[model samples]
Target: METGAEVSGQAGLAPYPVVEEVSSLLNRPADEIDASVSLGERADFSTRVSELNAKSAAGDPAAFYGQQLLLSRIYGLVTQLPEGPTAEGSIVVQEVLRQLEQATIAAEDGMLESGILDAAPAEPTAFLSWLKKLAKEHRVYKHPYYREFIRDQATADDLRHYVIQESVVDGRFDDLLAMMQVGTSGAAKMEIAENFWDEMGNGDPSQVHTHLFNQIYEVFDISPDELERSLTANALLSGNLAVLLCRYRNLYAEAVGFLGMTEWLAPDRFVQVVHAWDRLGLPDIGIVYHKLHITVDSRHAAGWFHNVVVPAAESERMRRAIARGTLWRLNSSARYLDERMPELASHR
Candidate 1:
């Protein structure tokens, strides 16, 4: 449970020369933020990224806003190494990530002010009811990506591109689940264990979820390097959000809400993807991943709701955190799915 301030060499997190005043960019007017921050083409973020991380820890929305790619990639580093940088570096890292999480959640909460989230229930069973209602009516389902994929209108290039975008988070799911179980116990732990076991392919390496997901990319010939390049900032934000919530124990309730939505979301989404695959004549092997998740994730979602989300909601503090986590997952995912549309169309 110890963390270190040092990043592993393979993590590609070498120190960039310190830059001053970079956090100011986050405060620029909304339209100007895009132009000023250089979301594309201007790659030199330097050590200002660290400064941003520090500021994010202080509850600055702009700070969380600017450093998602850095955050996401830092998490990728954690998964790649034999052990996470959780000693001294993790102490330093967790605080920064933890605060950044609050800032991000606060910002999203600000946006959803007076929205449907206001109706979340205080009691356990009622909260689950609220969560289900939110998931069912989530606007992301109406996403053009799903519509096209379900209707068989997506091209081979489109499906390939979609999966690559998905690799941003789905690829590291098992590791995330492991990080999630660190401080959990009793019923919650059991629920996560069940899901983790399924992810582990029920002790069969050949059937591991990550391996199954990779098979789709393997069929598409996306090298790890290619997968990295294919992901957009929005896509990385979703992944970053996952790592942020899971890496810190204070954020545990949020992690529960986040993963709850994820499990709940996947089955429906993957089912649509499968429809696209069969309709477009893609190989059965690539579609195999979706086919399996359509069943597994459905079961996982149900269990996660009952065992995890419900019990945790007993505390008002937990109720609030879980609400933030659920909305965070929903909103971050919507950002990725919505943005990828134009980005993918450009490739067609």
Candidate 2:
């Protein structure tokens, strides 16, 4: 399969001023732009940068990022689009698909790290600009499944809780740290905690996650790259881990027993994800939580048990709120997968 790059590696890409236009349009600092370039690629990048500058002077502001990101997404869809019935076009389609896959992943990753995913609880001020960019792209180009995902999965409503939480952390980081404490030996008030591990524990939660991912992919017609770009999933898992840790740190300071005792007993839920991926032959795209948590979560969970739970949770009400939130997050994440899976599968 000949990708766009492969088809026009020498000639087509030569005139593309994406580098200059992107840097100037985004108003990115030279340092940031330089950070993205490889050591040996400076010369080529310099040439592209000059072209981008020239184009920027002539093109519409909304068109550049919108078109580029849209194109990036199309590059992904090109890979995932089913080869039509004709055999003659299959090779070309296949090549295009590969390019799309690479481009989508790169663009999505770039968006994620750039606080693009952090745009939830979106301000209309910020979102209007962003929407125009996306709208222009959709009008001028196709981005396969990512366009729909942005429209459907990432509505203003979906961002409410995340935005609230972001505000809490941003405004109260020092206060939260002050609330940390030691743990004690007392058991949890709810009987649910006694058997909670078993009830919620599906042996390996990664298996469940993998199943959910597969269900989502087949049902939603989501491409592998788009699935990888689902930063909402990343935030959910991160929020849970932080809450768990905050509680633990409070508990540990109070001399309450920490969860480290039980940490080893519970199954390695994330590791099982690697197993599931291998078994299913799924790409590593959707395994963001699995990859991040397999190691970092252990320390985080332990810290939470030792510090936040023991010290701050002075009443059953406080404990209840924390536990309820944990339960709600789990339930919501699961339900989202269940509901979306069937809908997505229909697209297949």
Candidate 3:
């Protein structure tokens, strides 16, 4: 089986004219190509996907086509995996394929009309209103599942599970922040760096975000050891993967857009959670994480939107990337919350 790196090299060497290239390479019937290609003797399909991903990151015109083809191949392969198409990773891949298809069509259309591609990006102030409206209708905000959870319908175990899963997701913020700094200069870099500084507790060892969160768990008498042992929900895992995908692919503006939207929406989503905790008589110290974010993240979101996302979004392609990234995050989060709601309700 070819490694992803190897397949990536091949993908760059020639444009795929048909699906048979992948089928022939994997020794699977062209019509029956499926996720099973990634298993057993053909297990190199995963590597091929990774290789195609690297090409996509390069921003070459052919890279998008390669990614579309590679993803389609992987889509087939994952569908045939032992766990089948409904598996967590498969679902993520399905969503990705849908997005990639849309992007591919948009990119082709934009290439034919240079005017649309070259039009000036929306100004930050104008963009903020659009973003706000997006947030207002975002599934994370409007979904009944999240509302129920926020209304204190969740059991203690469910709450603990949520906290631990979120910790796992939030722990990756450093990586996302670093990605945002790439190709940035002057005021943009400075603004992002400050956000990073705050996230890291402004150089204070004892006040790091992770440590503060740990303190919150301590206040609730939830054992840190148990938190570590807790399993992460698939939805959270996929959501994190989507963010990292943008980062790893060097989708800088898109990454900033996603992160900014997350920060902007944090307060609204978390305020309810904080109220629930307070009603339960959980100490203030246990809930400071959410409280602190309400103010800090709002400012951070504004800074990132104006400084990073706005400037980089100078083209239609970039604007679309930003929108895709934001929606990807929002939808994944909603799915995560929705999945957990059923489990939590079972406990009730």
Per-residue lDDT tens digits for candidate 3, residues 1-348, read: 122221332223344332234434333333344444345433344444444445544554344445544443444343224333232344334444445444543433333324422333376455556655666766566555546666567665656666766764464465467665877798779988999888888998776766677776676566645543343333323433434444445566566666777787776767777877776776677677778787888898878888777776665576766766666566556656666676753543
Candidate that beats the other on lDDT, 1 or 3, i.e. the better one: 1
Query: For model 1, how does the per-residue alpha-carbon lDDT over 19-106 read when each residue is reduced to its tens digit?
Result: 1123223223334434444433133343344456566556553444345544554454456753422222333333334444555555
Candidate 3, after superposition: displacement of residue 306 in Å? 1.6
Winning candidate number (TM-score): 1
TM-scores of all predicted structures:
0.76, 0.25, 0.60
Candidate that would win on lDDT: 1
Cα RMSD for candidates in order: 10.2, 19.2, 12.9
Candidate 2 lDDT tens digits, 87-116: 222332233323323432233233322443
- For all candidates, the clash counts are 13, 45, 6
**TM-score of the candidate numbered 3?**
0.60
Model 2: residues with Cα > 4 Å off, grouped in runs: 1-268, 280-292, 340-348
In Å, residue 298's CA in model 3 sits off its true spot by 1.2
Worst 10 residues of 3 by lDDT: 1-10
**Quick one: ranking by lDDT, best first?**
1, 3, 2
